[model samples]
Target chain A: MPDGGDPTALGFRPALETVIPLARAGPIMLRVGVNGYGTIGKRVADAVRAQPDMEVAGVAKTRPNFEAERAVAKDFPLYAAVEERADQFGEAGIDLAGMVEELVETADVMVDATPSGIGAENKSLYEEHDTPALYQGGEDEDLVDTSFNARANYADAAGADHVRVVSCNTTGLSRLVAPLEEEYGIEKVRATLVRRGGDPAQSGRGPINDILPNPRTLPSHHGPDVKTIFPDLAIDTLGLKVPATLMHTHSINVTLDSDATADAVRDLLRDESRLFVIPERLDIDGAGALKEFALDAGRPRGDLWENCIWGESITVEDDDLYLFQAIHQESDVVPENVDAIRAVTGSADAAESVATTDDALDMGF
Target chain B: MPDGGDPTALGFRPALETVIPLARAGPIMLRVGVNGYGTIGKRVADAVRAQPDMEVAGVAKTRPNFEAERAVAKDFPLYAAVEERADQFGEAGIDLAGMVEELVETADVMVDATPSGIGAENKSLYEEHDTPALYQGGEDEDLVDTSFNARANYADAAGADHVRVVSCNTTGLSRLVAPLEEEYGIEKVRATLVRRGGDPAQSGRGPINDILPNPRTLPSHHGPDVKTIFPDLAIDTLGLKVPATLMHTHSINVTLDSDATADAVRDLLRDESRLFVIPERLDIDGAGALKEFALDAGRPRGDLWENCIWGESITVEDDDLYLFQAIHQESDVVPENVDAIRAVTGSADAAESVATTDDALDMGF
Candidate 1:
C-alpha cells in the first residue's frame, strides 16, 4: 500500500502501471567472473552468490593459494593467470579449464579487483572479450566509462560497457558531495582525508609511532578526482595520515551561493532514500557499535555500504554548511556492482533492478 | 627597519621596554621527560631541540631498546619502569635522577605523549610539583587549562601551567574550522574522518582490508573535543576508517545564514599570516610532492607541519562556502609546543613569543 495507489485506479497511466509491476520482478540470472581474488574480489564473489538473481560463474586468481583452493572447493570455476605456468592450478588439484583470459571471455560480466594499476589492464582484457566489467576504486579515475554509485549515478551506467567505482575515499566523497551538488549548486568543495597506512595483512606500513602529513601537497587532487564523476563541478582536497584503520574520514567544507539554514540542508539530505542521516537519538556508541548494528541488520557489509551521515553534526550558518558522514567502501560499492551487472546484461528492467536492490538493502541499517 | 622606528626613537613606554633582549632569553632551559618514546614523543623531542629558545635538558624511555639507546647517545637521560628498577635512574652513569614523579618535578615542563588514559594519571604529578606540562591530543579536552595553538590561541596559554594539544584529527579540524568560525558564526559542523588503520610501525591496527564505520555513535564527540578549545562551538563529528597509510582527510559541509561570495572568503583566508592558502599558480603536485618539499625545506620534522589550505578550492555560491586544507599533526603541534614552553617560562614576552613562533613557521604551498 505504500505504493499509495491501486494499479487499476481510473486515472492511472498505462506506462506508469506497467512499470509498477517491475518492482516484484523475479531475480535475473547473471554469469559473473571475478579476477584477482584478493580481499575485495572474494567479497564480491560472495555477495554475488547471495543475490537470488545472480551467480558466480567463475573466478580467477593470480596464484594457487589457500584462498584459491577454497574458491575451488566452493565449486567456483577457477582460472589462473597466463604468466604463471598453466599446470599451477592442476598441481594444486584445482582444475582450470583455461587461463584468466578464457575466464573473462566466458562470463557475461567481470569484476576487476586487482591492485591500483592492474585494474586498468584487467579492464582492457574484459573489453577485448566484449564483456562489460566493473572495476574497483583502486584504478585512476580516467580508466572507466563511468564511476558508478547506484543511488547517485546508476542511470549513467545504464548502457555503458565499463564502469569504475570511485576510490573508497572518492565513493564516500561523491556520495556526500553529489546530494549537496544537486540540492545546492556547488561552487567549490574542500575535503581532508585521514588514511590508513596498510591493512593488518599489510604489516609493512610505517612511521606507525608518529603521525605524519601523508601528502605535504595543498589541495590533494582527490577533489578533482571527484570531478571524473561530476564533470564541471569545482572541488579541491587535502590529506593527512593517522594511526587507525576502519574507514577514511573526511572533514568537508562547502560554500553555497544561496542562503540556507543548516536545518534546511539536513532536511534535504534526510529526504534522500538511499542516504541514512544517523538519528540524533539512539546514541550508538562508537564505530564498533555501528558496525555491529549493521551486521545485526544483516547488511551486505557491517556498516552502510551507502553514505551514513551523522545527524548531530549537521549545521548551517548563513550560506555555509558543515556536517560529518562515513562511507563503507567495501559494501557501498557492492550494490552498485550488482546494478552494474544488471545494466550490462539488460536482463532486467532498470526500475526492477533498483527496486530489488533497494528492497534487499532494506534489511541493512 | 621593519620595526618602523629608530631603535629607541619611539620614546618607548615601560610597556614597550624589554626586560631582556629577545635574542638573550637565556635558552629557557627545558627538561623533557618522555615516558613513552613513541611517534608523538619522539617528534616533540626533536622539535624541542630545534627551537633556539628551548633545549632538551633530559629525556626518558619506557623500555630499553635501540631507540632508547639512541636517545642516550643523544645525551638524553633514559629510564626503565620495571617497578622499583625505574628508580635506578638516579644511580645511572647519566643524569637520570628521580622517578617519573621526580622527573616531572625537575623539568620546567613535561610533555605527556603517552597513549590515551595515561595522561590523566600523570596530571597529579605535574600539579604536585607545580610544574607546567603539555599533554598530547589523546587526553580528554577538560584535562588541560587550554588547548594551545601557536597561531590561533597562543595567548590563552599565557599564564596557565597545563595545556593540551588536540589530537591530530582535531588539530586539522580546528585549523580549518577556526577561520570559518571567526569569519562567519558557525551554525553547525559535520565532519567525516577518513582515518588510517595504523601508522607505518603500527601494523597490528585495524579491520585490515575491511572499511568500517567508527564510533557508530552520532556526533562522535570530536566536535565536543574541539569545543574543549572553543567551548561555545556548535560542531559535531563522524568518523570512518579506510585501508590506507597516507593521511586522514575530512570532507566538510557548512551552511551559513548570510550570503557571501567564495572569493570574499578565500581572500580573507589568504590574508591570514599563519595560513598558507595554496596559490592558484604553482601547479603543486600531489601529497607525495608536498611531503618531499617539506623535507627539502630543511623543516626540522619535514613537511609543512601546519595547516596548508588550497587556494583554488575556495568557492561560494549564494551563501555557501567551501575550501580544503591539510594539517600535519605531529609537526603542526610542534610550533604550539615551542610557544607554550616560552609562555610557561616567562623568559620572553608573550607577544614576542607569539610573533616569533608564527614567523618561524614555514607557511606555504
Candidate 2:
C-alpha cells in the first residue's frame, strides 16, 4: 500500500505536484480581435481560433480588399477599422460584424497590426474600451509598458496593459539568446542581419540590385530594441537591406561567460521549440530552398514559424559561439502574437503558453 | 631648396625616397587580352584602356551579344572565344579581331573573366602561350599562384605567372583590412556578406523575395578567399543572398590588437585612396541612393571602384571595431584587375600601381 501510494516507491522524497492539460489552462474562450487583417493579422486570427482557450472575436480592416474577403471566407467576423470607411464594405457587398469599437469592446484583448506609427495612434481607442492591447514590432518601444518575447521575458508581460511583441528580427534573436543565456550565461552578442527589402507581395520596396546598410550605422536600432527585452544583455547588431523578400538571414556570434562546446550548444538550441536546428542531410541551401521545403511540407501559406538555424553553423571557438539562422519575417511573430495574448492576460505561464501555442500551430518541424 | 632635400631643414632623419610619374611605370605598353567580356570583362577592358602602360590587345566573347556589341562599339578588338562559334560574330555584323588563340598569343597578359570553373580550364591555354594571366575572383583560389589586392600584397603578385584579384567583397575587405592590420594590428575579423542575387542584367538569378544562407554553414568561402590574400590573418565570414543585384554590402567587425578612437580610424581610412569614407552630409541612405549619387557625380558607368565605408558607422568599443561598407560587385574589382596586370608584369610597386590605377580611372569619389 505504501509502494502503491508512491511515498515508499520513490527513492527521493517526491514533491506533490499535479500536471494539467495545457489546452484550456490559460483561458476560457478569451475573445481576440485583430486589427489590420494583412499578412500578420490574418495569420494571428487563424492561430487564435486554433487555440482551445481563445477564439477570434472579429477582425478590422480599412478596406474590403482581397485579404478582408479571405478573412470573411474563413468565417472570421470582419469589421471596418476606420468608421468612416464602413460604407465602402457595404458598397463592395461584404458582410460586416460591427465597427472596430464594438470589436474592441467585445474582445478580451486586441492585437494591433497597423503599419509603423499607426499602432501608437490606435492605442487610445483600445484604452477607451478598457481592453488591454498587443502591438506589433513596428511601433515605437516607448508606447508600450514592456516589449515581449515569450521565451525571453514572458513573465514581464503578465497583466501588462500594453505589450509589444518585438519585431521578427528581435524575436528571432531573443529566442536564440534566451537558451544561450540560461545555459552558459552570455558575455555579449554580435549579430549581422541581412534583411529582405520587402515582403513577396510588396514590389515597391527595393534596391532591386543593391545591398544597403539599413541605417549605415553600428548597433542599428535592433540592439537597442533587444535591450528592451533583456535590458542588461550586451549586444551589437548591424543591418543590411537586400533584394530578398523571403526571410531575414542572421549571422550570429555570442561570447559566453563560460566555455562551451559546439555540440552542446547545438543540443541546447535544438531543445528550443522555436529554434529549428536545420540538419546537414537536408541540403537546404538558402531561403529560396527553405520556402520550397516549407511548401513541400504543406505548411499554412508556406510559413516557417521557427528560426531555421543551420546545425553545422553552430560552432564554438573557446567561449565564443557562431551560427547562421533565418527568420521568416512575415510569420515568426505570428505565434509570438498568439503567446503575447496569454502573457498580457496573465492566463498562462511561459511554459504552458509556449507549449500550447506550439502545439496549436504545429510549430516544430 | 633646404626643405626639399636637407635632413637639417626637416628636423628629423628623412628617409630618402624618389618621386616619379606613376603613369607608364609598371609595363612598357603592356598588351592585355580580356576573355569573357560580360559584366566584369567589359569594365576591365575600359579600365585597362585608361591605364597609360596598358592597352587592350582584344576581347573574346562566347556569343556576339549586346555586351559584345558594346565592346566593339568602344573600339575594343573583339575575338571569338569558341572556334566553332566564329560565324556568330560575323553573322551579327561584328568585325572579328581573330580567334581567342590569336589574342592570347599576341597579348603580354590574358585577363580571364570566363564563368567560374571556365577560367581554370582557360588557365592551361595562357601557360601554353607563355602569357601571364590574371583571373577574376570566380576562379578557384588554387588556380592562381597569388591572389592580388594592390594595397595588401602588390609585391607578392610581382613576377607571378598567374594572379587572381579577390572578389568584390574580398577586395573591399582587403583594402579595409590592410590599413587596420598595418595601424592597429588585427587580432581577428568577422564579416557578414549580404550578397546580390545576380548581376543587374541577369534576370535568371534570384530569391527575388527571400534571404538565403549562401552555404547554410560556418566560414563561408569568403574568409578562406580573403586568406588567399592575407594568409596569416584570422577571418571568419558568413554569407547571405538577397534580392538586390546592385551591390554586395558587408557588415564588418574587427577585434583589433590595440585600442583606438573612431576619429583616428576614420582619418586613417580616409588616407587610403581606395577606401571612400561616405561623409554623413551626403545623406545617402542605402545602395539605391548611393548609385544615384554616383550617377549625379558623373562617375563613368556609375562605377564605384572604392569601398564606400559609412563614416558615422565606424565605432570602437574597447578593442573591438565595427562599420558597414558596400562593394559594387560589377566594377570594384575592375581597378584591381588593372593593378594585377602591373603587379604580374613587375612594372610598379604597390604604391605606384595603386596611384596609377586610381588616377587613370578617376577612382576616388
For this target, which candidate reaches the highest DockQ against the unseen true structure? 2
The DockQ-based CAPRI class assigned to model 2 is medium
Off by over 4 Å in 2: A1-27, B1-27, B61-63, B66-102
Candidate 1 lDDT over residue span B216-281, tens digit each: 444565777777767776665666655444445454545556666777777877766556676757
What lDDT score goes with residue B48 in model 2?
A: 93
Strongest candidate by TM-score:
2
Residue lDDT tens for model 2, A1-365: 01112433653112111112333354357689998999889889889998988899999999988998888899999999997899999999899999998898888789998788889999999777767789999999999989999998998886567889999999999999999999999998999988888898998877566677877767789999999999999999988777678888889999899989999999998999999999989988778778889888988989999999999888886667899998999999999999999887666799989999999988877
DockQ of 2: 0.58
Q: Per-residue lDDT for B1-365 in model 2, tens only?
A: 01123434654212112112233344357789999998889889989999988899999999888988888888998999999999988999999989999899888778999888899999888876767789989888888888888889888876566789889989999999999999999998988888888877888987666777777767789999899989999888888777777778888999899979999999999999989999999988777787888999898878898998899999887788999888899889999899888777666777888889999988777
Indicate the worst ten consecutive residues by lDDT in candidate 2 chain B: B12-21
DockQ of each: 0.13, 0.58
